[model samples]
Target chain A: MNLSWMAWTQPTAIFFIVIFCLLITMSIWEKISPGGGPRVGILRFETTRGDRLFLSLLGSAFIHLAWLLFAGSNLWWAMGVSILYAGFVFSFV
Target chain B: MNNKPFDNKAWFFVLPVFILVAISAVIPLMTVVNYSVQDSFGNNQFFWAGTEWFTEVLNSDRFRDSLVRNLTFSAIILCIEIPLGIAVALAMPRKGIWVSVCLVLMALPLLIPWNVVGTIWLIFGRADIGLLGFTLAKMGIVFNYGQSWLQAWIIIILMDVWHWTSLVVLLCYSGLVAIPEAYYQAARIDGASRWKVFRYIQLPKMQRVLLIAILLRFMDSFMIYTEPFVLTGGGPGNTTTFLSIDLVKTAIGQFDLGPAAAMSLIYFLIVLLLSWVFYTVMTNYGMDAPEKREVES
Candidate 1:
C-alpha cells in the first residue's frame, strides 16, 4: 500500500480533478433532466443520452490516438476530428 | 432495429458532422497525398517527385518489417483480450452494490492518458524502485524491459491488456445485463447446462458488443504508439518498432516527409482494408444465425 513513489504532478492532479468535476456535472445533469430512455440509433441498437456521451468520449479518445499515431502530435487535426465526432454523437446517436 | 419514417430533413442534422470530419480527415489526408507525391526542402518550395517516395517506401525492408510487427501485435492482442475479457465479465456479479465498485475500478485504467500509463508502468517495472520489478527481481528473475526485446514486448502487451480489457468487460457487461430474464428462465426450464446456456443465449446476445469491442481493440492496437514509445522508445534494438513508431521516426525524427507521407497512406489503407474484412466476415457470420436474426426482428 506504499505510495511514496507516486508523484502527484500538476497535470496528473488536474486530470483527476477534471474527471471528478465531470462526474459531478453529469450526475447533477442526470438528476435535473431525469430521462435517458433508450432511443434507436444507426448502430442497430437503442442507446440513451448517457450511452451517446460515453460513445462520443470513447470515439474522441480514439480519434486523438489515431491522429497521434498517423500524423504528428500537433493535435489540431485531432481536435477537429473530436469536434466532429461529438457533433455526430449528438445529432445521430 | 427501428422503423422510423424516412425524412430528407435528417440530412441537415448530419451536415455538421460531415463538415467536421471532412475538414479534419479529408483535408489533412489530402495534404498527406500531396506530400507523398511532391518533394519539399524548405521555404515552402516544392517539386513533383512522381511517386518516387512511394516506390522507395514500398521496397524498403524496414517498412515491411514494421508492418509485420504491427499486424502480429494486433492479432496476438485480439486473440488474448477477447476471450479473457468475456471470461472476466461472466465471472462478475450480475447484481449487487459491488457492481458499481467493480466497474469503476475496471474503468479507472482506461481513463488514464496513454503516456501516463506508459510512465506508470515504466516506473512500476524498474528493479530498483518499482514494486513489480522489485518483486520479480527478488524471485531471481532478470526482467529488464529496457535491455531485452522480449521483455519490452511482454510489458507492452501486459500494459495494453490491463488498460483495454476493462472496455471489453464494460461492453460485455452492458450486453449481458440487457438480456431478457425470459431467456434464462427458459434455459432453466429446459434443464440447459451452463455451457449450453452460454453458447445459445449469452453469446448471441453479446454479439453486437463483441463486434464493437473487437473493432475498437483492433484499430487501437494497430495504431499503438504513445505507450510503447514512452516505455521502450522502440527498444534496445529495433525490436518493438511497430508501423506507427517507424512512421513517426521517419516523419518527425528524420524529417523525411515524402517517404513518411507515402508510408502513412499505405498504413491507412492496410488498416481500412483489414477492418473491412473483419466487419464483413463477422456480420456475415451473424447473418448466418437465423435464430439470432429472428430474435432481433
Candidate 2:
C-alpha cells in the first residue's frame, strides 16, 4: 500500500550522469578503434550470421529471467553451478 | 550464403525488448531518483530532504563494509570460475552427441532461478537434515552455515561456483568449437605436446570468450543478492553483508530512502566501470586473433 521512492539525491543524480557520460565515451572509442577486426563493419557482417549473436544474447537473458521467476534463490545456485560447468567447456571441450 | 534482401522488419520484433527494458530498468530507476531527494512520512506526506541521506550513507561504516565485502566476493568468484570453466572446456569432447548431452546437463543448473538455488542449498546444508552437512558430520567434519560466518561464506561461494561454472563452460565451449580443427591438426603434425598446444593454440583461441565470461561473472557476482539473502540473510553478524544486501536493509528494513538510492547508484556505476574495462580488454585482445583456416577432410 505504502511505497517510498528512495533513489533520487545529489549523489544518485551525479552518479547516473557520470555513467551516461562514460557510456557515450565508450561509444566514441568503439567507433574510432573498432577493435582491428575484419574492418568490414556491421553492414558487411549482415551476410554472416551476425543476427544470431543478438538472438543468442536476448535468448540467454530471457532464459535467466525465466529461471529467476520460477526457482527464485534456487535458480541462482543452479546457474552458479551451470557457469562452472560451462567453464569446464571453456577449458577443455 | 543466401543473399536474401536485408530485412528491416526484424527490428519491429525487437520493439518489445526495447519497451520491456525501458519499463523494467528505466521506470524503477526514475522512481529511485525521485526517492533519493525527498523525505516522506506516513500517508504519502513528503518534504524536500535534499542530500542529507546521501551524505549520511556515504559516511556510514556499514555501507563501506558491505562495499568491501561485495568487491572481495566478486574478485574471488572471478578468480575461481574463469579458470575452472576453461579447464572444463578443455576436457570436453570436441564433436559428439555426448557433447550435446553434457552441454544440456551443465546448463540445467543455470536454468533454475536464484531464489530456488538458495533454497536448495539451504535445505541441503542443514546439519540435522541436509545431505551435505550430515555427510560431512558423519565423516568427522563440523560445518554449520547457519551459525558460523566462515561456513556461511564457504557455502555461498560454493553455491555460486556450482551454479555459474556452467555459464563459463558453455561460453568457453562455443569458443573452443569455433576454433578450426586445423590448429590442432597442425600442432599434432608438428609433434606439439598437449600442454604446449593448449598454451599456444587453445588459450589464444579462447581469450575473447574467457574475457566475456570473466566480465559477466564479475558483474553478476557483484550484484548478487537473492540467493545469499535467502540463504544467510547477510549472516550471523555482518560477515556476509554484501553491498546489495546492505542497501536493501537500509532502504527497506530501515526505510532509509536517500542513502539506499545513493548506494544503488554507486553500485550501478561500479559495475558499469568494471564492465567497460572488460570490454576494452577483450577488444584489444580481439586484434590478435589470426585468420584461421578450417582443416580439410
Model number with the top TM-score: 2
lDDT for residue B37 in candidate 1, whole number 0-100: 63
Against the native complex, each candidate's DockQ, computed on alpha carbons, is 0.02, 0.14
TM-score per candidate, in order? 0.68, 0.69
- Pairs in clash, predicted candidate 1: none
In CAPRI terms, model 2 is classed as: incorrect
Q: What is the per-residue lDDT of model 2 for residues A1-93, given as tens digits with 9 covering 90 to 100?
A: 334434345554675686578557655654555432232333332111222232333333334334544555344564565556444432332
lDDT of 1 by residue, A1-93 (tens): 642223223433464566568668777876666556567778665667776776676577567556655675566788798888988986786
Residue A59 Cα positional deviation in candidate 2, in Å, after optimal superposition: 32
Per-residue CA lDDT of candidate 1, range B1-297, in tens? 235554669889999998999788865776676677667675566666754776678668999899888889999999989999999999889899999999999899999999999999999999999998999999999999888889998999999999899999998988888787889999999999999999999998888778878988998999999999999999878999999999999999998888898899778777765675565556555445446645753
Clashes of 1: 0
Candidate 2 ranges beyond 4 A from true positions: A1-93, B1-24, B278-297
Taking every candidate in turn, the Cα RMSD to the unseen true structure, in Å, is 15.1, 13.4
